[model samples]
Each structure stands twice: as structure tokens, then as C-alpha cells.
Target: MLCYRKHSLFTKKYHIFKYDNEIHLGETTTKIKYTINLTPQTMIDWSINHQTKQLNGFWLIWKKQQKFFLMDATTCNLFKQTLNGIVTYGKHQILYEPIQSLLHSSFGSLVKMKYLNSRDSYMCKTIQKSLQYTDDDFYYQIEILQSLNHTNILKLKEVYNSNKNYHFVFDFPEGGSLADLIKTKQLQFKEVQLIIRQLISTISFIHSKGYVHRNLKPEHIFFKESNNLESLLISEFELGCRLVDFQNKHPNCRVHGYTAPEIKSKIFTQKCDVFSCGVILYKILTRKDLFDHESITYDEKMMLHLINQSDIDPQYQNLLRKMLQFNPELRATADQCLTIIDAILERTPTFSNFLDRFNLDIIYLIYL
Candidate 1:
């Protein structure tokens, strides 16, 4: 129920009604007026925003362009609480019902879901927390995810806990993982540049906050929309941790080719992440897995030879070499790589046009 109304002149007060499976936002049940079908299954994107005259605003967009706004924080908060209650305890209480199982492993499965009311798709990762996670470990993970508020990093929207498993809800990238795209598309040079720049910038942000994403690979890199490389996102945080200024030693995580060589000796740091990014860059440019050979194994010499033979610009190759250096101390840092990438892009004549089309810094750039 709304205590504040946008049109106060009307004597009828605004109200919200929730049935067993649907939610209604209008004046009354007998005489209803709503922006759209208000149900948990409808695909609606909503947010709270600042408004003029010392009021907070709530806005909703659904079915593409249709929008609704309520210029009061109290109303929005109340509405959120109401929806949460229905989602948590209603008859069909599974707010995000699983639509498909995307992946399965010994630990758990990653399931694609559709929110019952809004119909927006989401990816839900179920973790068997009881087997390996303590109470502190669970809460600590939630805290870390909450703290990491970045555009490129996957955002954790909701978390649910059962007796044996923990369910985490994240925005689903319809475009799928970088690995999927690499299997099909041979990316152009400018596309490679755009992807790598965003990847390094995100890594730099994560390092600045004293954390390291131990698992940084093509499979974990996702595109928000299909065929839209500029909408890139990095996810899968099961191995990420805070470094506390490199004062503590964290456990090593190994992915065949993306893992830094130094990690093989249990010496891991922020530089390891940079090496992973470099591996991804190589994969994007060459459309080949760096070390995934069945019969013929790739030694460092062979790998270097392959990189040299690739068609990417020499500048990127040189940067990749620096990033994939065996010595941790000699590896380029995220900031340093970002600087080189920026310089390379700036030197290009088409750089300005590129920015106008694909700059992630401009928050309003949308896919046509």
C-alpha cells in the first residue's frame, strides 16, 4: 500500500495487492489501474533513484520501453518488502524457478532461471555449502561479493540458503561465455582491443581493493548480450580472495594454460591474474587455446613461436609476452598493462570513433 501518491489530488489511495502467484499495483482490486501485468513472472527491470525536492524515486521498465515511476522511497521500499515476502513464503515460493541446468559438477549445478514475477532470466549457482563451507566462510563470501560493486564483475542479486545448499542469483548473460564465442567467431583486432581493455580495467579495479580473482579465464568471462563483446562481464568467484597487500600467501588455483607458471610452485599474487588475462588475450586474438593440445604438447618455446606467428599487432604480442613472463617479479601489473593498452588504442586513428561506439565509460551506450 502506498502512503504517498504522485497525484495527491485523487481521493483514492494507491495500493498494492499480492495474490498467491501474482502481485497487483493499483488503486483497488474492484477498480484496478496498473502500468502493466504486475506478476513475479513478468520481465521487469527496476531500480531506486534520487529525485528532486528531497525525495527518492522508484522506476520500472518492462517489455522493452514501457516504464512506470513512483517518486517516493517509502513506496519503493514497501513494495520491495512486499515482493520479498511473497517470494520467500508464497505458495509457489521459488521466486527464481529453474528453467534449465546450464552446468553440472560434483559440487553442484549452475541453473538458468526466470523470476516468477518479472520473467527476467537469471543464473543461479547452487553450492553444497555443508560439505566444505563453515558459517564464517558463507557470510564472508557474501560480504566479499557485496563489496565488489563493479560493472564488469558479476553482481550477486539474491542469496538463499537451504539445509545443505546455498543458492546464489546473478544476472544471466544471454550472450554466454567467451569460451563459447571463441569456438565459433574469429574476433577482429578492434574487437579484441575492446574486450582486453575492459578485462584489464576490471582487474585493476579488483586489485585496488586488495582482492584477487583466482579464476580468470575465458570460460569465466561472459558477454551480457549475444554477439556483443563490449558487454563483457567476468564471473565465477569460488576461488577469489582478498590479498591484504600481498602480506599473506593464498592457495594456488590452476587452470591448465591460464594459470601463471609461478603458481605451480605455490607462489601466487596479483600478477597471476594478469597472466590469466594475457592468456585470454592470446586466445581472443588467435582463436586457439594456449596449451590445450592433445598429441603435441606446447612448450614455452613453441607457445612463443605460435604467438609470433599469430596475426595480432606486434604491440599486443609484446604486451602478452610481458604478461605471460615466468617470473612473478618481472610480470606486468594490471595498471601497467592498462596503460599500454590505452596507449595502443590512442595511437590508432579510429580510436575516437571506437570510443563513441563502444566505450564502457559511457554508461548509456546500448545495443541496437
Candidate 2:
């Protein structure tokens, strides 16, 4: 790729080329002839500015520590093309080591994949390519994942499409999904609170961005560390839909009980997401699926018994009531729920006393 720097008299040329399948940039001048390797992680930002609808040269901000490259139109296009095919198949194998182990294997397989050159590991989600999934669908999910930037949300590093499958490289949460945790042991009240707080905060962010995560069950929630329940991260956005796109039409709810009842009418909104969170909170607290036993028509008496169970803390019970309100308008907004939770936590001193009296053997979930 071609790059240039402005000198007092004229522009000095710099060149970027491939060496041993790795990209390199160096100045042409003999006095300062130097080359540096550039990888996918090195490219921080690349953009071509426009002024009043007119094209301008692109500024490529890449760094090992701190480096910049300015490329003209043709050079920028070439660099982009190189990046597009940088990790197609053969290069993907070269960059990332073989899959270490399987994390989940239901609809698709979630495997632990590590980098060849570094100790860092990531989860690779492999989904079989079928006619059911189109280019537009894949791109839309990519756009949504790229748009989200949050601490409690799983990060998508790269996407690879092979002949038979599509690979989504994601940050590996060592503790695994919340569902995994639930199947092993009952969580402390404080742990449940921490998970709910993080979930609501991230959900607030998602709603602000005009998107609703129709599915928010335990399987979609993960923890960043095995020992730290507070290090939670939410993942899986396949059922997510933009609010604007659904102004006139909406898809059916994918997660049966977790989604709000209004979704049956093909209506979805930010409130519906809040309702799903309410169901998750109920699940974590009671150690039971909210609608696991319900049929096409829910058992209203049983559902109410589960919701109004006396064992759940009164503060959470109150919050659940507002969140799980039958009418969408009566339901609490994520922001409102967050505020309520904050106040509840502040007033409840025992909220901080996690595992003070319970035996570690009784509460801890052994991964092995």
C-alpha cells in the first residue's frame, strides 16, 4: 500500500507491503528507513474524511505503540481489500490455534479458541451456513454487535465465513453462562443482585441505542471469571431487533417465557426487554424457570404463585411486580428499575454481606 508524508518542499513517499504474509509499513528515505509489522489489532482507526460531500484522502491510525499512515484513495482501497481477506480460512488457521475444547453444543457449537502467537483465548461460535441465514441477516447482526460498546457485554473481535460455516470470535468468559452456574448451585442473594444490576445497566444502554434484546435468559448471560460473580457479561444477540425497523412490523418472541406477553401480538419495545429481565431475576432467585411448565396458554394461578412467593425478598418482590406487570404501560422502564435497585441496595445493608455465614462448600459451583 502507498502512503506519503508532507515535507516543506513536497510530499515524501512511504510504502506498505506484505512480508511473510504479514503487513509492514516503512519510509522510503535512506536516512529513516524503518519497517514495522501491522496486524489486525494494530489498526485502531481508518477513515476517509469528507467535506460537503467531497472525498478526501484517508488517515490510517495504526500503532504498535503509536504510528500513523496517510494513504491516498487508491492506496486506501488496496489496504482495505487486504484486510478483507486477511483472515479468510488459511490465514484464520495460521493466526488462531486449534479449538481447545467445546463450551456448548446445541444449535451451534461454542468452542474455546486461542491465538497462536499469544496466550489470549477467545470463544469461537460456529454456525452451519444454510439458506435460512442470508447475507443481510449476517451483516445486520455484525452492525449491531459493532455498535455496542459496554463493559458487561461480550465483545466480538472478528467474523470468519468459510465454505460450510460462519465463525464469530468473541471474548471468552471463563465462568461460562449463567445457566451453567444455575445448574450447579444456588446463588447467594448478593450474587443475584450483582447480576441483575449489571443486566439492567447494559439493558439501559441497549435501549438507549434503540434496540431490544428479545431474549435475556440465563443462557445468554455469562461471567468473565469463574470466581467472581460480579464479572458478568451478556451475550447472544440473534433475537435482537432495532425498534425503528419494527415500527410497522415485528418478529415473534424467540424465548418463550422470558419475553413479555405483548410480544405475542407482534409488538416489542424497550419495556418488553425489561419484562424479560424480570423473568431472569425470578429464575435466579427461585432456582426455577419462570414458564418452564406452562403450555400454550399459561397456568395463571401457578404463574402468580411463582411471582408472589413469600420467600423472595420484599424489595425484589416489589421490583418484580412492577417489572412483570401484564400491561406494557404499567411495566417499569429499565432506567426506572435501575434507580429503584440502586435505592434498594443502598438501604439494604445485608446486600454487601455475601457469603458471610453460608459454607463455601454449599454455595460454590465447582467447574471441574
Candidate 3:
């Protein structure tokens, strides 16, 4: 049995009983029993919170006695206080109803309020169902995030779990996604080069941790600032993109035309990311969709198709062919890609050489 002493914050005295991995909390001893999973700290956190309301998803103050605790109505009963404080569960009331309404109408997805930070920004996400509801997905996410620390990868702040749901809180990036930017025709060649480098570095990190980002597409690549070409941010990990997701379980990877042949056969590895990277590079270089017929004009498609099918530019064609290899084993590794990129960079002539040949202002801009 776990016992908690009433603090100055709460006026009532509450005693908690624990037996057989279950805990009971009430104002006084009662014959009725409610099944609950409790750690010593969970009951302690609940005892300190003066406010307890049904609509406000079981309330509990996490920090108490210099320790953190997880508490909800199921785990423990709440004690009443003389003063009333706002507490209710269910869907949280958004202070900016207009914004919430707009998002709801636009997305038309069920958004659950997860957490409210010190900045008053609410963290919310659409609920998703998973085949494995246990800690498999949760642990996989934690392991992947902890393994790779890069500017291009999305930042996960924390995770919250209740009896009915799980929530992931992440650092919000204002720039939207690469997919959106590509739609606006804002991505340039130099910007694409930078983005690809960052992405390769991130993929290298993931591979180092023995994981493959099965789903690597423009939509998954988030941005920090909408028009900022240098912005770096990424998000979305709900899919089976982790090592555990692929561990001994064969599932066909999905990413439209970006998916490699090995992925379709359910034999994916780090090299699959290289194939996706090639597709992304093709899009970046031409600023046209490789698959979307409506987005790419006939002339653009003809040009890209020709370049892809023929050796018009041997060097570029070689690189593209190596990346788009049908077999995973034949594709380039992250380290190999890095080396190739370095070679390409070294081969690129300086602006001074161009100026010497054509008497151009390119050298001045480069020097400046």
C-alpha cells in the first residue's frame, strides 16, 4: 500500500491502497474497488492536486515532493478543495476558437489536445490507429530520435500516454513542408543541393543506428520557415519507419515513385533511402514531379525522361543510375553518397575560371 500526506496545497487528507498491481484512492475507506495501475509517485501526484473535474481528463499535479509523477482519474481519486480551480477533461476548450475551428474545418480530422506549454501554445494531433498499441511503436520512436541528432530531422520534445491514447509532442516548424514549397516552385538548385546534403547526413545518422526511413518523401521533410531557403526541420514518424518496424517483419514500403524496387519486394535496407534521395534530387534539379502528370508539363516530362533514359550528361547520368539501382545491394550507401557528393563538389570549377573564359561578373559575386 502507498500512503501520501496531505500538503498545504490541498485541504483534504487522502489515503491510497495498493495490492496485486492495482491501486485504490478515495476520501475514506470504501468497499467498492476500481482497478488501476499505480507507481508510488503517481498516487502522490494525484493527492496534491486540489482541482479534480470529470470533463477535464483526470487532473493531477505532476511535480510534488521534488519528484515527477503520472496521474489520471483511473489511477487515483481526487480530493476536493475549498477554492475552485478550472478542471475538466474530454476535448480542451481552445482559447482561440476561430483558429481551432478553421483547422478543424480545413483538416476535418479528429484533433486531441495533448499538452499546453509555458508559451501557451497547444500541442495537438490527429488520432491514428496502430496495429501494435503496446510500447513497440513508442520505444522505436524514442530509440530513433535518441540515435540521430541533426538539423534536418524533426525534434521530439516529449511523449504523453493515457489509458485511451498516446501523444507525441514535437517542436513546431513554421515553414510547412517541402511538398508545399515544391508546389509553389520556390526550390532552386543551390537550395536543393543544401537540402540533399542535410538529408543525406540525417539518413547516414539513421543508418548508423541500424534503421531505415522507409517513407522518405517531400511531405515528410518539414521546414522551419516558409520562404527561408536555409530553413531545416523535419517531422512525421507515425509510419513504420524505424528499425523495429522492419525487424523480422516484412511490410511493403510506400512512397509513390520514390520507393525503390527492393522496398516493393519487402527487402529494405539503408540503400532504399538512397533511391528515394535520387528521386528527390530529380525533383529538386527540375522542380517537376517525377510521377504527378498534372504538375509536370509535357516539355518538362520529355526533358526529364530523356535525361533519365539516356546518357545526355554522363556524369549526372552515372550518379542518377547508381542511386536508382533496382537492387538494394547495388545502390550507394550513405557514406558512398557523401564521397560522391564531395567528388562532385571538387570537380565543380570555381567562378574565377568561368570569368577567365567569358569575362563574366560571376567571380565578383563569388568573391564577395
Candidate 4:
């Protein structure tokens, strides 16, 4: 294929060539004419003066539009030697490395993809379900997730389509899920506050946007650490939806001890997410092993009892009690939780904090 190079307005050079019938022209700051695609059926005509090597002329008529572009004399001569009816350049094909290792298969639809850049990577999510549901659900989820920007929510990179599943790529945080990170140890008071603050902020933002997370659990919260600062991120939007547009009053709720009781009565509200947050907080505060799956098999009712039975520090006891309240109306909202967090943060940490006051070195010595 004939190739041309052009320095952008900023003088950054990029290879301009036709690939798969599309001219892959790109630079970091381009806002227009990024790429151009033409099918085999496309009618186009162009010629270059053999000596002058300038674009004598070119124009394409496709459907109702006629388009034309000019190439300077310098560009014309640059590709003249290999310009053999636009087919001489060797074809470049993309190869996929076989997925030999999988980090997660909870959804039974994960394919480890190639690493992309220094700070980002790609993983394929294959989604397959009954055809009864319209494909629009995928677009709706994308719309909501794309518009949402928060530290706690994972960022979606892009999406791809296949015969069976809609594959998604997300910005993978290096530090895995909270469930994976906190298995052996409990967090200090300041760490817990930082994590809870992010969760509360995430829920409140989504609620304000008319969407409900519907599923909230520790596993959904991922950990990210950089420059000695830590961050918590929420992932898995498979069940996320707009509260106003959602028609299913009784959608199946995931995560056993984390689900609220009102879900059984076909009642849905933002408070449901708050309840799940409470379950996470209780687990973090007490560092107790949550009731197991076997309990779920015997009776789901135990989950309701599990939430209320957590004996936490008295300071947070009142806030947790309000958050995990069995009655939907009595359940604390995310905004309310934020207010409580502010109050907790404002107060001096003595007995109120989950962790005892200590210098970092002393605390590490104690734990070590």
C-alpha cells in the first residue's frame, strides 16, 4: 500500500496509510478527519503526475456525497515508487495470543487479553444469555457507566462484539478486589474512613444520576494504591440500572448477607445499596468471617439476622444500626451516611475510632 506521512499542526508525525479499506490517520490532538474508510465498491478516481509527483487530482462519489482531498507535491513523490495500484505494501495482520491463564471466572466469561500500555491493560468479558432480553440492555448499561466519573467506580475502556458475547475492556487496578486484599488483616481507623468515604460518595453520585448500583459488596470494591495513598473502586455493572427506567421490581439480588430484606417484598430503593454498604462496613470493623454460603443454602432469612447481629464499636454502632435497619424507610441513605462519616472524621479519634491512636512506626511494630 502507498504510504504518506504528515506533520500535524503541532508538528507530530504520523503514518497515513490505508488499512482494511480505512486510512488510519491519527495523532493525539486531532479533532477532525481522524480516519477515512472506503469499501471495495466505493467509486473513486485519482492520478499523480509521473514527473512532478503532485496529486494531479482525486475525487470519490459515494451515495449522495462527493468528497475530495489534496496531497502536497512532497507527499506524492514519497509514495510514488511503491504506489502499485495500492496493493504492493505487505499486509499486516493482528494475531491473538491464546488465553492460557485466567484470573477470574465467576461469571464463566473471562478471557485474558494482551497488555496494552504501561498503566492500562485489556481483558475480554464474554457475555452470553437468553435472547429474550433485547440487546438494548448493553447500550443502556454503557450509557450509564460511561457518564459516571468517580474514584470508586472502575473506568470502562472500550467494547467489542462477538456472535455470543459482548466483550468489554476496563481499566484494571493493579491491587485486586477488597475481598482479596483484606483476607488476613483488618484496616486501621483512618484507612476505614478513607474507604467508606469513597463508597458513600460513589453511591450518592449514582443515586443523584437516577441509577442504582443494585449490588454492593466487598468483592465489588477493588483496592488501588499509589504514592502511599490508597483508593477503593467499585466494579461489575452487570446489574446496574436507572431507578426511574427500571421495570423489574423483583430482580434477583446477588451477594447473600449483603442483600436487603425489602427486595423480597418487590420494593426497590436507593437504600438497598446503603444496606449492602453497611454489611461491608460491619465486616471491616469487626474483621469477622461473614456467614458462609452454606447458611444461604439452608435459609436466606439468616442474612437478615446476620446484618443486625454485628456487635461493632459503640461510636459507629448507631450509624451502622441506622444503615442496616430492616425497615426500608428507617434505613439510612448514602447522603446520611456521608454526613455521619463527616461527623466521625471531625471528631477526635479516641475510643470512637475503630483503631487505637498510635504512631505509624509503633503501629507497624505492634502488628509485626
- Structural similarity to truth (TM-score) of each candidate: 0.68, 0.69, 0.63, 0.64
Model 3 misplaced stretches (Cα beyond 4 Å): 1-127, 130-135, 162-164, 240-245, 252-255, 292-306, 309-316, 349-352, 359-368
lDDT string for model 3 (1-368, tens) is 22233445853334555455444555556742233343222321122233433212133433332322334433333321100111112222321121231123221132323222123333343333345444455555555665566777776554444445544545556676677777877554456657777777778877887777766777668677667756766555554465555754444334466666565456767788888787777776666555554332224345446556753335456666677666577778888887776666566556436657665566667788
- Runs of candidate 1 with Cα error greater than 4 angstroms are 1-93, 245-254, 293-298, 350-368
Candidate 4, residue 345: Cα displacement in angstroms equals 1.1
Predicted candidate 2 versus true structure: per-residue lDDT over 87-194, tens digit per residue:
332124434665676655544677787864355788877766665554455556667786788888898777766566667778789988888888888888678778
Model 4: how far is 251 from its true place, Å? 3.9
Whole-model lDDT, model 4 = 0.60
167 Cα displacement, candidate 3 (Å): 2.2
Off by over 4 Å in 4: 1-107, 116-120, 132-134, 226-229, 248-255, 289-311, 350-368
lDDT of 4 by residue, 1-368 (tens): 22333235533334456455555444432432345444222334445555743454334444567544445545643533223222111110111222434445544365545531122344445566444323465565666676787777887655533345555556555576777656856777777787888888889999998888887877777765542226677877777877876566235445466767676566788898998888788778876644454453323355445545655545576778788777889888999999998888888355444345356557899899
CA-only RMSD, every prediction: 14.0, 12.0, 9.6, 11.3
Q: Which candidate would rank higher by TM-score, 2 or 3?
A: 2
Query: What's the CA RMSD of model 1 in angstroms?
Result: 14.0
TM-score of 1: 0.68
